[model samples]
Target: MSTTVTPTIKHTALSDFKEITKMRLSLSVVFSSVAGYFLGADTISLKIVLLLALGGYFMVGASNAFNQIIEKDLDALMHRTKNRPVASGRMTVNTAFLIACVFTILGIGILYSINAQTAMFGAISIFLYTSVYTPLKTKTPLSVFVGAIPGAIPFMLGWVAATDNFGIEPGTLFALQFFWQFPHFWAIGWFLFEDYKRGGFFMLPTGKQDKGTAVQIILYTVWTILVSIVPVFGVTGQLKLSIVAAIIVLSLGLVMLYYAIQLYKKMTEKAAKQLMLSSVLYITLIQIVYVIDKFIR
Candidate 1:
């Protein structure tokens, strides 16, 4: 229940906190929210952007902290997670809880200062991740479906933060990310099947890297690409993309689809990893293209 490290290596303790927060993942999540902000913003303010980054990081960090706390013992059983702060006994569970509390309070408070709606969604994401998704991971493969709810919120949360309204525009942004998550997560689950099983977590839809799983990934990849290009046709509200931007976005989707199809054809860990990497690139570049096209138009 107590940390073994002496006070001489205080920096190590700080690093533990950063690890506990999953800083890289949290930062990446914030980037998506920021992209959403840019898409919806009429006039950008440095202050708001900074706040969105800070508040979003805090919310995601809080969620990660709580997740690590709950998964501490399970994490220790998995090679990839064995060295994490809580799992390795570098940080006491009480210390992690304290950090989670501080992050949660500051995160929601900052968003509340921005707008009540943003604060509400921020709270919802935290609640869903920690309470529902975390516990359900080991219990059912359906956890991915449940997890996608909170996962998709950050993208739309930014739009709501900017406009203070939750409507078709925000829903469209939510839908794009919602569908994209299926392939992205399934690819990781497919590649990391053994690691996740070691921790008693089965996240893949079919619970194995079989044709059923690969087919689902391809279908979702197609769904993700189609939803992304829909805005180009001006079918969705206020999310119109120029013809050139549409072409670029479609090309990116094709690259992602190519990888997904490869994964389906080979059903190999190597192909799954390739799909995972391409999904990361596809989501990030698509967001960038959208922002650039927004300004171009």
Candidate 2:
């Protein structure tokens, strides 16, 4: 006779699973992929949409889990991450690794059901995030640039999933999201500099809050806005935004830019937090507006 895993250990593992996966963050990334799918899909099926969401969530969860596994010791040193399941000793590295393996296999299989390209990109995003970006955090600020590649993939992944092709349209969408990540993440880095430093992660462009960092944030905000409105000029192949929708996107970009400018001026935690919120709003609303335009026009 053998004793089974106890309820206490089981419950702890379950809770630790959620903590290690960073469920909310994973879900947010999935939301971007869903928006991409909706925009690229000509005839949306409930089943495919659901599968995309599930696959996306699983992929991001796996990436986050692997990142935590790699950084468990470092995470234990930072107040922001000290309570994370693996960092807190609530879960073993072996358990986390097994969970990550399961999520990765399921995620890739689900995306493959949509298309091979989608599956391949999903795998790439996880690989970049876990294998590349995770290790670079402590080495160089250029890690943010490396990290943005994977970060930007989901938005275009949906388009690829729907069309089963990589073309100018998805490329444009990818460019827009890629540039947006700089300002979005830089704002977070600005506010959380101390917490990140505790973990030996230097994310800011200058690795400190200063004029140079603020200027780069503003510049990226400009780049993100320009890429977003390019479809209005009808340069892209599949994606074309109406003037009205472009105007709305432009207005939202201005709002984000305003916050970016404010961060440069104030250089305070409040301003950085405000910019972070604006970046979130800008991306979410812009994606929604684009999908709405696709349907309306």
Candidate 3:
């Protein structure tokens, strides 16, 4: 009789690296950064755009990886996040920590090579996201507000990377994204209320997905719409939007508002999901409109 030996497969560091980065989310973050770069830069260069996107991706990815490491236990409790690499035991805490460190350093270094202002913003985003927002999620509903600071930075960071200065242009970009986040996240909170509760996260402003929360969502949605159209008035300095773009953006906002109202009336998972989808479309469409208006006008 002959005995056969089976070879054991060892996990590669590269596979673990991908898991820690949360590639899908990183890509989305990079998209926003690139959109901001396009809108802010006077002349868009492919090389700079690529660098900003990659740098933004690594910075946001590092924040997310550290967040997972910090919230691994809580994540295990939530069905939506239970299978995350760290929470599921597929990646160890030490491994995740090292990956976060590497990404953070690489991200900041790349951004610094472009401009120091961008690098500083990137570092601050990571710090606020990981050090403040992650732990605050379970302690207070205000965590969303705290997280928005870092979340809104990407758009402005792109501007700083290109222009090497922070002014009305980047400020407007920051404000638009800042207001946009409230509705986007609240819609998500509405849909994931149950899952969030499992992890002791108070994501909704009212701490419950009820009429009050829905009202707040609508209020913020209105504010976001107003800010998005501000540039059309041509008073926002370098960041100006045209009448056509304003109309297009307003139409998208109305669609989002319609879904928000529907969610308010029905207060069901389906309605919340629709609102969430609409929120996503509203942001993306408005960003594209801003860039288009910049070139057209």
The C-alpha lDDT values of all candidates are 0.91, 0.93, 0.88
Output the lDDT of residue 168, model 3. Answer: 88
Taking the tens digit of each residue's C-alpha lDDT, what string does model 2 give over 1-297?
998975543446666777888888888888889888888888998888888999998999899999999999999999888878888887889988999999999999999999999999999999999999999999999999999999999999999989999999999989999999999999999999999999999899998999999999999999999999999999998798999999999999999999999999999989999999999999999999999999999
Which stretches in model 1 have alpha-carbon errors above 4 Å?
1-11
Count backbone clashes in candidate 3: 0
| lDDT by residue for model 1 (54-133), tens | 99999999999999999999999998898899999989999999999999999999888879999999999999999999
Number of clashes recorded per candidate? 0, 0, 0
Poorly placed runs, candidate 3 (over 4 Å): 1-17
Q: Which regions in candidate 2 have their CA more than 4 angstroms from the true location?
A: 1-14
lDDT of 2: 0.93
Candidate 2, residue 277: the lDDT equals 96
Descending-lDDT candidate ranking: 2, 1, 3
lDDT of 3: 0.88
Tell me, what's the RMSD of every candidate? 4.7, 5.9, 4.7
Give the Å error, residue 195, model 2.
1.1
